[model samples]
Target: MTSHRYAQWLRDSAFGSLPHPAISIAVTLGYLAALYPGTLPRDTTITAVLTTVFSALGACTGRVLARRSRGRPEEQARRIVFGSCLVILGSAVGMAVWWQNLIRSAVDVAPAGVGWCAAATLPAAVVVVAIVAVPRTAAVVAAGALALTAGLLAPADAGADEQRLPVSSSAQHDPGTLLRGELRVGEFDAAAADLARSWTASGGLSARAVVVAVPTGSGWVDSAAVDGFGSRFAGDVRVLTLPYDQVPSWQAFVSDRSGSAESAIAVVSAVATVLDSVPEHERPRVILYGQSLGAVGADAARVWLENEHPSLLDETVLVAPPAGTVALLSRTPRTVLANSSDPVVRWSFAELWRPHGATGDTHVRGPRVPDAPWLPVISFVQTSVDLLGALDGAAGVGHRYGPEQAGPPHPLRN
Candidate 1:
């Protein structure tokens, strides 16, 4: 009798219906705790990881039973119900993370609870939609759309409030009109042409010098710098900055950088090719300048600059170059105005990639410049208060090299 009872317990435990609900409930609870954060830790990394693993497990279990689903309605229904609960819980957690971040940014206070269930019915609604939705194709597309939306809506860097500006009319040096976001190459040319014509009318070509400036992430042109160049150099110093290939975000900065660099080469080359056709005396000395991602664009333009027009760009001014800048074109004699405490520019130095080393060091693109006795021409400036500044704002506060930091005669003004 005892042996038979132990055998029965083993069979029940191995093929038990109990495991399904037990795993589901534990996963659901973890997700709930992560998503709700009512009085829990604001840091959601651990819970987010837990919910992700459980959701994946639930999905795998459902898929394993999919082949036999038609034969057993009851079993199929159980798996379906379990998977549905995991997804439902996941949506709740995603929203909670978003909400908690938002409120924290707004009030600058610690949230008391795990997170506010501002919309308590959100999870139920998501589950209902998921159940009724047909064709897994739609779900895949929806998931992609959700990710894109989240990336696009990410918060701007600090001081964004003061930095946000539409590309508009200039005060002193006419930096072409304000650019709209995500422009095609042709559209950019058209805008540049319009601005060039205006610049010519304002005695631009007559001054025999031009400066093309790139704005920050939020499309802010350094009016002060442009204005300063116009006043200090006694030249028209025309400035033309551009918008992004798409909505700006830190995550997609590399793609944005690649696009901006390609565009810069094309637009600047076209403009320069035309200007170079003029008599050497009549041709304006073309200069390049960019801040943040635009600074990145400046660095990337080096590949083409060296390949196509080695001496076309006479000078360059890059302020607060972000991480991943490997500007190898020392031929342009560029000046990097960095805030010593700014992690943005500092990260660029730490971003070492040699021809032989760790996996991250495997950059097969042309020559490795960082180790090449590289004269970065960096002018690092900082103040006492800059120690606490983040990568984005340190340059402005510590180094005082912001858009408004213009007005002084820039080193390239010579």
Candidate 2:
């Protein structure tokens, strides 16, 4: 009698844990929605994140509705859920073919077959189901175990200082008297003065053109842009970079941006002062170049130039500036390079309600999606999620820009 009672309790518990019919329907719809196309191709990791989030939301909502409606007969619930499953599965198969064709045509990528779709969605669904069906204590324990395993298995990166040491070294070894320096917090004036002195010491006052290449948050100046400058000026120009932060661009973008702004202001000011001392005929053309978060800093410097010294800057090149960041210095000769598929240049809350490509000033680049329709809130959500993999695409696509970023501000037609 005792063993039979124990077996009966186990069976009841298993049956009770089965998801309600509402949950099956909700999660299926949510998972299908996650499979919709976006600006970039969704890889397994991205798809998993989207699937898990949507499924969790659906599961919670379904559980609440089921509880409020009280219980239904088991046979009726089973029939409804089983019928819904067949319909959903059929829709998923059709959606998979359409999704594959859309991504292939739009991005020129190989097919993401139905297998890929299943691989991306199934594991995520299982994980979400485990969390939703398990008791709170068991769920917490599983999550903790997973985190610990990940921490143990994941590779560790070098320390921040170690990563930064190489930037200065690389700049020194690059061609054409490329000078790399750092900006000191609370010592902008002193740093600027020292930078001016360095320009004089390095014989840069004699160059016909000087390019101030502002680095992103991690002090990374694009080598292609530097080489482009050399090609543009016949190796007669001086390229100076004064980097500020040591953290990655995304971290600095979210945490503190004042460093890039302050450094840009100081370096440009210092370079301008030194150039002013030279004879007018001998003064080098001042060209400012920045990419990603660096563009934000360069924009700040442009504003400062407008107020303090109106005609100091000759031209500016900004690559992949964040969404909604406009060029305030309309008077200055400006070149903006943006890829239509670049999430960094298009991710914004405004996309939730309006069409993209509405900006008149931005020059959109190629490898663009041919048929990426902008659907109100869906586009916004997909774009926001795509930010995680913005840099994953090849050069000239998504957030990656090539040496063309260094092309002349105003090109002459052939």
Candidate 3:
């Protein structure tokens, strides 16, 4: 077709509401794209959610491309569109098989069988059909599906004060006991006071250093980090964490990021108050720690500490901190532990155009996936997909940290 005619088609695709073969093919392509695997293997639930969400989004995208014009394509355009769709779909299918197998092999997981694939794609197909045949109903279904997904992904401990008893009663020998359970939604200060009082009663003030850990959105304190703290400090360190929310991390992140920060500030303030009661020469060092969504709170707490009581804050440790939210530098010593394979640490939109981890910060660790190449839009899509299974990877990879995550805080520079 001539350039003028091609421009006209483009306009029609962008504005017209006509049901074009190209639009349908595009929607199919989107569903197929969602089937391609990322850095980790996915379970059936993740597979269905990913496929359905992407399919619905793809339908909306297709609508935008073919929304305004009701004009039908020419015979030649129709033939060409069909031929192109075959080539594109065949390529996508081949890539889907290869990529899924590659990722599963890398993660040492069993390959998903054909039955699993069919079952996973069924929901996506249904959602796509609804979108094409009944747009309003499809919108409601998509919204509900997303809400259900958020709820399903939340941790078991999300939202309730039912605390998991410590493996041992001794907080020194079993720092995991320091979890202290969660408070209700708006009583972070009260929870902090209670936690501080509990720690003081347990002889926590005698430790060489006290680390206040910030739990993730689901009130999860990493068992690995707790164990590491106990082992590294040789029972001379106190670890304390305050739970802030019961929702999934992403939901909390979008709807109430400041709440996490407020929770951290409350805990830090409470800890600092207790430290003030001890003699200046005998006061224990204070180290702030957080991981993932916890890191968002830790970053905020670090800022509050820097401004309100700089002397009380000795060091900060952030593991797999979300890319955009973390403060890279600190007035006090700080360590940033990030795996190169972790999408949570490197999947910001800025990565679409520039390489990350190039900043001259001493704390930023290098990439673990040395051979992985960064492509413009492709990398973004790959990482976005990877976010779905980030926690499924083994320790020290993706979003999973090992016991080393609780290592001693960064030493101050001379």
Candidate 4:
């Protein structure tokens, strides 16, 4: 009786325990659908069904692994296989949610409010608990989760924000001579000034042009743009990066987004302050960049990029700017880079409100490779591993943007 009770206890805890796993469920399905971006139906009904089935399977697999993990090698093998599936499915769900939200709504993608951040990270936690019966698999899941957590924080970068730069030093800075400098006041203002000074110091800014970059959800400043654009961009252009104090919650994310938007506006304002001190010929031109939630903040500041000043913010370059980004004023030279494979850039359905956008000389939609002929089986297998590519911070043609195998020439500069 005692042995039977112990077995039952193990079975109960392991099985049927993902009662509130919607967050995990969404992420898992989305990642899978992304494998064959063009091949998949991309319908919410399909995703809803997949999420339900995946959740049920997760519950079933967790239980079976828990019950049979202590059995013979064959049973342990089954546990390993099941445990592996759980982690893969969780990522697939994430991909689906990401795709759908990109096509759906930019501002409130993934229901940004209340307990959203916990929902974002909980699936991995759930996986850890479910696979505990298999020590080896458990370790793999835990390690993967830990690595993801690290990438999900401030990405490896070097730049100055308000926390590092101050207003007093603003007068002393020169755009042509600075390398890595400091910050103060609103994060965007301090960083923008730093870039302005760097450009002046380099004495290489082309037409005084610059690319103002906005960080992602984790406040990761994009080094890709800075490295890719190079000096002709500013003679010595400054990739003026804006900082949003990220606190790891939807409210905080949203709050930071609003602040980042306001800060983006303020950055423009700060650049204006510094530029006013210099001659019109010496002032640097400005452009923009953002991704995921960063796109939300950067895009929200689109108005400043438009009217009120002819020379300021000559153009706008938005990467995966999200659903419902307002179309730029007809005259604004803007470029929007999007990927059909990234739900973070293009998921939409009837229940979801996908905002309309502009079609212009600068719009590009792709994943480097043309979508393969629709094959559900192949797509699923492809995206399963592709998500790992996303976790590593980037990819050539999928969700996260990396090297463009082939794309337009000089988008921001043009």
Q: What is the C-alpha lDDT of each candidate?
A: 0.48, 0.69, 0.70, 0.47
Q: Candidate 3 regions off by >4 Å?
A: 1-21, 28-37, 43-77, 112-194, 246-251, 277-281, 341-343, 346-387, 408-414
RMSD values, in order shown: 13.3, 4.7, 8.1, 12.9
TM-score of each: 0.46, 0.80, 0.68, 0.49
lDDT of 3 by residue, 28-107 (tens): 66766666545556677767776677677777887677676577677567567757765775576566656666666655
lDDT (10s digit) by residue, model 4, range 50-138: 33334434544544544554533354554555566578865644564554445334212233232332343454345434544354576
- Candidate 1 lDDT by residue in tens digits, 1-414: 699897887656534332244344444553453344221123333333333433434434444444344553455555776788768776865666565555344324355344334333343334323422332653575577559856874555434314544444422332342222234444665555555555556666766466666655455555556665566456445666555443443433634456557556655765665676677766777777776677776656655666788767776667666644655336656666654334354443333332111122111221111121212221111111122234222223322354433322335545
Task: Give the clashing pairs for model 2.
Answer: none
Query: Model 1: which residue pairs collide?
Result: 36-115, 37-113, 37-114, 37-115, 38-113, 38-114, 38-115, 39-113, 39-114, 167-178
Indicate the residue-level lDDT of 108 in model 2. Answer: 73
Look at candidate 4 and tell me the lDDT of residue 175.
39
Tell me the deviation in Å of residue 128 in model 1. 40
Q: For candidate 3, what is the total of clashing residue pairs? A: 10
Q: How much is the lDDT of residue 138 in candidate 1?
A: 37
Span of ten consecutive residues with least summed lDDT in model 1: 377-386
Span of 10 residues, lowest total lDDT, candidate 4: 156-165
